[model samples]
Target: MTISLSKDEERDFDREIRPLAADPRCQRMKRFIQHGRITTYEHSMNVAREAFRLNREWHAGADERRLITAAFLHDYFLYDWHTHGDRLHGYHHPRIAAENAGRDFRVSARTQKIIRSHMWPLTLFHVPTSREAWLVTLADKICSARETLFERGSGAGHR
Candidate 1:
């Protein structure tokens, strides 16, 4: 089931994400599918929402802005990985997304690291080192698994 934010939560989330959402580059994610029929934009928003919920539930005291930003931009690599799947997209996307976030958003070193490390043991060396990084990493895994497993079309032809 899809999650819905409360009225107050929606206000807070919109405030936090509005600046990024206004950018055409970020908006372009609507055209790229991340899993099943879910667009990258939708997946990123879900990851951000889940990360925020996890942080609150665990009382993790992570920086909210940093956590949300990193979560939403974690897959900001800007290309359709499917048509151009080189087998390295899984291993390389974190780095590419981090670079794009840094360049486009001027994110902090901490935020960039959080984005870079979201792929975790899959990337081996790029382990999450901060509260926010770990939150985004776990949230990414949760959202990706949900989309890849429970989404429509019989789980056919997805990354």
Candidate 2:
């Protein structure tokens, strides 16, 4: 679950991603745990940071601003889904996140699409239709898997 960025990457993160991620509501995500030992805020930062690195490495044509913004807001469901009593959290959080992000930030349609489709395959019909969306999806899975499988119990808490 460690987000390892080089100096230049850190500069990129600070310059490109930190401002929006510093939003008050976004900061509140620090209170909620995502997978295993990571806070939702930490997880979102990891995703966005990684997405930016990937975009640089791959020249993937994904819009950097949109990708970072969407990554930060992809899990903006704003609650601990594990304890929310929602039976369909996996299928539903993406849309909830999309709505909340749009309402709060006036994100573009492309960013909304990235947030709404990041949990694809589990979300089934909501396939990623853009390069940025696909990168967010892949980054989410990688970060989630690493957090859940390799970093479990360091700070894990029960719902």
- In terms of lDDT, the best-performing candidate is 1
Report the lDDT tens digits of candidate 1 across residue range 43-129: 998899899888877999999899999999999999999987678999999999999999999999899999999999899999999
Residue range 1-159, candidate 2, lDDT tens digits: 457778987887788777887789899888888876678988898889888888878989887889899998999999998899999998999999999999999998878999999999898899999999999999999888877766654365545
Tell me the lDDT of candidate 2. 0.86
Residue 87, model 2, lDDT: 92
What's the lDDT for residue 89 in model 2? 92
Q: Itemize residue pairs with steric clashes in candidate 1.
A: none
C-alpha local distance difference test of each model: 0.88, 0.86
Model 1 per-residue lDDT at 135: 96
- Report the poorest 10 consecutive residues by lDDT, candidate 1: 150-159
